[model samples]
Target: MRDRGPLFGETVLFTGTPKSPEVFNLVKQYGGTPISLPLIQVAEIEEADDERKMNECSHFDWLIFTSQSAVEAFRAKMLRFGFSADLIHSKIAAVGTKTAAALEKIGFNVSFIPTVFSADTFVKQFQPETNRQLNVLFLRGNLAGSLIKEELPFHVVEWTVYKTEKQLSSIGKILNILDEATSVNILFASPSAVHIFAEAIAASRGWEGFTICAIGHVTEQALIEAGAPRVDVKPETYTLIDLVNALARRKEGL
Candidate 1:
């Protein structure tokens, strides 16, 4: 007989792409069944003029990346335009550990990460070395808000490098999971995914009969506003590794 893991028999569904394959494997290591139901799709916005505008990236004093999606889009554009990391001399600020890791993976050193992994906090905590008027470029998706650009005292420029759209195809798969599994854990990584789930599934069926786990406060608030009965789990730190560890601890009653 095999030893039972902490998450024995628990069905874990990911509403967003797992940061890495390790996240999915972690659930299985704990004896849980991992399922993927990405509720949002992100793709780079390929504008013909962007090839010219991308040159502006080298002029900014600071380059900000708020999400892994933004990093991915920026990377794709850089590769498309034949731009190298050495060409962009701007200091990089990443909002979360994952974003920073993604930036670092591409040979760019990250200069800043806020005390918390939230944009609201990033706006409050990020300060450059000098008080001079600095040019900051924020690379983001279409669904992103203007909080950083509006709140930052620096001269900010926004480049919409990516767009996020609802992944409707996952709706049927999620419903199928609900039908087959007696109890399942649904992990929400972004508020966008939460909103999609609310509109497509929760609106018709209601937010019940599943364990809800949110990655950050923003995502949790989205679930609250969507009228979920409750959010069953959330990590203290807004990272996928922490979120999964938190779920395991919850299952272990720690």
Candidate 2:
């Protein structure tokens, strides 16, 4: 990395899973002190018809994945049931680069990614190549919104591959940071995490000197609703790596 990078003197408090060391490494790569305090946890949902759905994968024209967690959960389920990617004939659509990368790693090709990485933009930009009616399957978590199914112009079916749960065990440490740190950069990746943080930390600590960073418009809106006076850093691209780069740029005032 660059010596004394843009984020040289910053302390970044990550609110996502610590299982993703890449994100924490990114902060350190940019010369920032990274702190891991997961605000949410993701777990696979064991549905009764999971085997049947896996068997019928080829029936859908498109498979949509909104988060990397969904991709990982799907991959795990596929492995547990001895299913292979060869069984899938449908084109894949991912909401973000990381999700697409995860799908690619699992031997599937991503056919579409929205200009912006949010579902609202995805619905507006995604369209079928032919006039024929298309069948789509969205693999998502329990907390995923209904915007995709409600807005897509095609026949859409949803499969809950995962569930996002609040992780408030680290609230004490988060409170300690807020109380002791002179200044901190708090990064939020999802709306669910924002809500948890709002309840556990923000309700008491408030947003005083913390530099609130959001991954995308959705999370940014959540932060705004959670009483973040202003979002200090938000990348045009909505990904964790881009979020770190944006934070570095902000530190350097570029």
Candidate 3:
């Protein structure tokens, strides 16, 4: 099974924020020496600033959740203020199955989940009505994609519930590991992670023996734009598990 795992004995680094430990364990389960150097930190936005907008959630016809982070962050902050969870009575649209599952865990019914996981695909499937205007309340992070807002002619009211910040605590040590690792496979969960990791290792030739794995086209584009010459792993499903499995398949080929 370890041989089938394909990433056996490989040193793979994870840059998934707020969920790094779980991902680290997954890498090990697949027989890789998992490294966790968090490149991003997920934090809830100021409650005082977002409170009014969050309380006004009942005005929308559609409640959109783009990521699990947004769902978690919103619940944590809003529940602390004794905010009613019943504000989400509108039809719900989740970008991916994970997000839909997260919403379901919170006891919200998911009305739609796109076949494809990207924002572009989700946007394409949604048909906007000019006559019967719809108000969509988008709960998202600071670095969220604007394709939903750009493509749909809905009255979109977005609340930035969370943010991603750089978590580069020990850059020198991380760089050393990057240089010394025999066959490094860096996994990026978001565009910010790819951008930060790429910038931090730009001057070092440490990436010569490394493989860059991006979760989606957005993150893959970030890696390419940051000059990552070899983005060897990109999954079509665009989930963390899918990304890891794709890496396993790539290693099997090698």
By lDDT, who's the top model here? Answer: 1
**Tens digit of per-residue lDDT, candidate 1, span 76-100:** 9889989988898999999998899
Candidate 2 lDDT trough over 10 residues, lowest sum: 1-10
Q: Order the numbered candidates by TM-score, best leading.
A: 1, 2, 3
Write candidate 3's Cα lDDT for 82-175 as tens digits: 7755655678889888888887877788888888787888888876444798999888899987887878778888788899888878466568
Which structure is stronger by lDDT: 2 or 3? Answer: 2
Q: For each candidate, C-alpha RMSD in Å?
A: 1.7, 1.7, 2.3
Q: List the candidate 3 regions with Cα displacement exceeding 4 Å.
A: 1-4, 18-22, 47-49, 128-131
Of candidates 2 and 1, the better by TM-score:
1
Clashing pairs in 3: none
Candidate 2, lDDT over the whole model: 0.89
Clashing pairs in 1: none
Candidate 1 TM-score, true structure as reference: 0.96
Q: Which is the leading candidate under TM-score? A: 1
1 or 3: which has the higher lDDT? Answer: 1
Model 1 deviation from native, Cα RMSD in Å: 1.7
lDDT of 2 by residue, 1-254 (tens): 34688777778998987546787898887888999888999999988888988988889999999899999899989998998788789999999888888899999999999989999999999986887999999998999999999999899999999999988787898888877886689999899989999998888778877899999999999999888898998999998888988888888775
Model 1 residue 38 CA deviation (Å) reads 0.4
